[model samples]
Target: MSRRVLIKTLPLHTNYGGIVQAYALQRAIRDLGHRAVVDTGDPISLRRRVLHRAWAVRRAVRMLLPARVDWDWRASREVLAPQQSFVRRHLSRASAVERADTRRGRARLARRFDTFVVGSDQVWRAAYAEIPEQFLEVIEEFHGPRPRRVSYAASFGRDDIDEYSEAERARATELIRRFDAVSVREESGIGICADAFGVHAERHLDPTMLLTPGHYRGLVARARTDPTPAAGRTLVYRLDATDDMLRAERAIAERVGAPAMELLPTASPGSYGEYAADRARFDRPSVERWLASIASADFVVTDSYHGCVFSILFNRPFVVHANARRGAARFDSLLGVFGLEHHRAGASADGIDDRVFTPDWSHVNRVLEAERARATAYLVENL
Candidate 1:
């Protein structure tokens, strides 16, 4: 039986983590022979970061160059809309569908989608100071109770729901009640929903776990078809990653006696051409090639949860650098989930340690599969 499904998430169409989550869910829905349409609430909104015209010009220039090219057009517009009317107008003009989400427009929009899956990122944070009530208001108007509401891999920090303010707790309770089922990404989230919202949300794995490393191997193979780092070593880093982390990666590569290369998730074709121009010890590969390189590397050093998850999945020894900017506490919460304390700290030049590299994935896999099955069952029944 085929049915239409709508997915609402945070930071969609940008970042490997967000893309992988959205892609995996949509893929799962499609595998079940359903029509899944994923549309996220704007990351930038009237209550969020305000974007300015000057910033827009600077951003437009930045997008044209290889440096500071990690901008996600969607995320940028969402985070900066309140501050920059020019950017809001700019992206709004470019996007025909999302721009019409006015109070008068929402009623008609609600009639279109059969079910809405709201989750897979830091959207729960909206209950905090950063977001406005309108965000939930719009979603509630579009996806009311009994319309097959489900939350896939949502998360809250280690602190209990009592940690939230009265307004936030009230909002959370109401939203959680409206959902048919809510599945969280970490054990902490279960406590949060139960204690704070008075709703029962089961603990589940991040959607990235739904697919095995073997499933991602095709992109890896494609990435390695012609690669200089294929025979040596490589390090993939996200934009927010620090210089110290890169140094640790290089030191590990050097200790292993292999040349090292850097990997970027998003870059222009011409940037790849520039990287190709450099015949030095370091070489850049396509994103697929980068993932392949990590799979085939002497060691992997990253600040990404997916990177850490996949490293363990592939049985590769890795170092997960704490992301200080985003808050290492969240990383700590996730690391605790897999019992991977050794690989969960700040970066160091330490050579690959077998103990840290080796985790009992056999046990982890069983837990992960059960969560995936639960999530799948929710989607299947809702449809």
Candidate 2:
């Protein structure tokens, strides 16, 4: 008996990790012989599209005001073209099917699926984005009072629920209690489920890690034209640009004995230092090219959870810049899985005690295989 499962996660955007996770989960579901459907994308109205374009132009103009604000809209536009092209090529098959951003649209979309899944990102966190209150409404739009509802690898992105307001806490508690099954990407999220929501949530690996290295290598193979980072280059894929993260990145680069290839392109105004140049290079590579860069890099240094996940998947030696501002506990939880916790670095880079930069791949692989089995079983049982 086949079932149509609708995955209700974050919208597909330019974020490499987000896109990859969505792809992996859908692939994993389909591998179990279940049919999975994700909304193609939200339909932006003409008025909103005009406002977005206007906002982009206004910001671009403000950046060009005198202080060498270090921004370029042309570069941004050019960079986004390839990123979107990647989506159209790889994800459009399963995803280019629905766009439900309205009441009638959601109701119509609900009629096409038998089950609904909500998860696999910082989507549980209110501040990650301005996700509409109606994202959960799709589940209720079903013909019955209850439709199969599961949350897979959902993350609150923090150690505590104190960030949510009183009303938010109540809403989360009520909504999560309705979930037939619940699994979170981070260990801390388990505690959040118990303490904040009174819901028992199992801890599961991020969907990206559910796939094998060969799976990612295949993506890279298909993207043959995408240039990878130069061999022996230290890939610096930071999500946050704190002074401590920069120091941590430099130290890892030195330890790896290679020139650093910084991949992220975000910098705040008036910030000085080596990362200042990042603002001018906002053209983050296509998702496939980004994967290629990580796969080929001699070593990786990152403050991103997905960065560490990809480094492990690609067998790249790496160090984690455990930036507290970006939820440092996530680093601890991810590294703990492969016994690579020593690879974590603090603001001053002192927390990193793993002198031998590389982990025991044999040990990590064994752990990966075991965890992958458990994670897969979780998907199977729930599906």
Candidate 3:
């Protein structure tokens, strides 16, 4: 029998991984013969909306008012426009739930589905600790039939649960105990659930990993009727771009005798003014183009987790720069799973050239196949 599954995660965020993970999970669920939808409607108060705009204004001022302006507002828009479009066309259709902030609102939302899922990202992180009642979907004193609650690959962002206060922690533990089934993205997250909440959460692969490379290839190919063939060029996708990382990318491009292409942020433009302008004007690539960029790259250098994920999926040689700001546990756990620990690059360019080598696909594919099955099985049994 087909069941309706509603997934609640941090999908409204602009991050590529966050968006893609939501899409992947929904797709995976549907592939298992169930109807899956993402709860993209998170009720934001007027005050929060005003604060968000203020934050954007501040960031824009900082990026634009610099002495030698390193970021371009228009260029950022060009990069993000397609990504936003992709979400609208591909993801928004499944988003039927309305914004629910109050108990009444949540109950109305809950009545729409049979099962509610929280996660595949840092939905349980400390920053969201205060809203555990909503984001975690554990409402109190409702007379209506309760939906089965579960978490798939939910992460805490960090290894420990120190972000929550003592009171908050106690409340969170109580809420967690209410989940019918729980799973985490990282192995350390499993420990966190056990020690912090006394909950035995299973570890599962990221949703992006749940889908095969062919699934992505088909999506990208459909978006681009006239696909750009691989030209053995170096693709640089940096979420947290740094001077050292840029230098390494340039050096690698020089060594390979191919131009270095970058996937810059739509919110924070980089210092490459002319390149940014050119991309904004002529080569405004959408999410499809972004995927194609990674698919056709001869080599890739990136700090983003999804960036590294696509590189591996396409079987491209790549180097991952450590992005500690986003938390290293995610990268460490993922790399360790695929046995690609040596792919991590240092801040310096030392031995970087030597680090670029084809991965052992025979081993990596085997691991991915097994892990994918396990992840699918967990969802099948739970949902």
Q: Write down the TM-score of every candidate.
A: 0.70, 0.82, 0.83
Clash list (residue pairs), candidate 1: 43-78, 44-78, 44-79, 50-82, 50-83, 50-84, 51-83, 51-84, 52-84, 223-289
lDDT of 2: 0.73
Q: Clashes in each model (backbone N, CA, C under 3 Å)?
A: 10, 0, 0
Residues 102-135 of candidate 1 have per-residue lDDT tens digits of: 6444554455555666667555664332332312
Top candidate on lDDT is 3
> Runs in model 2 with CA error above 4 Å?
40-75, 93-107, 130-135, 141-145, 226-228, 265-282, 349-351
Instruction: Compute the lDDT of residue 346 as modeled in candidate 2.
Output: 60
Clashing pairs in 3: none
Tens-digit per-residue lDDT, 41-106, candidate 2: 444555775787899889778756664343444445445667778767765344322344455655
lDDT of each residue in 103-175, candidate 3, tens digit only: 6766876787788888777787777533464335444445687888889998887788777778778877887
Q: How accurate locally is residue 56 in candidate 3, as Cα lDDT from 0 to 100?
A: 88
Positional deviation of residue 30's Cα in model 3 after best superposition, in angstroms: 0.7
Candidate no. 1 TM-score: 0.70
| lDDT of candidate model 3 versus the reference | 0.76
Better of 2 and 3 by TM-score: 3
- Per-candidate Cα lDDT values, in order, are 0.58, 0.73, 0.76
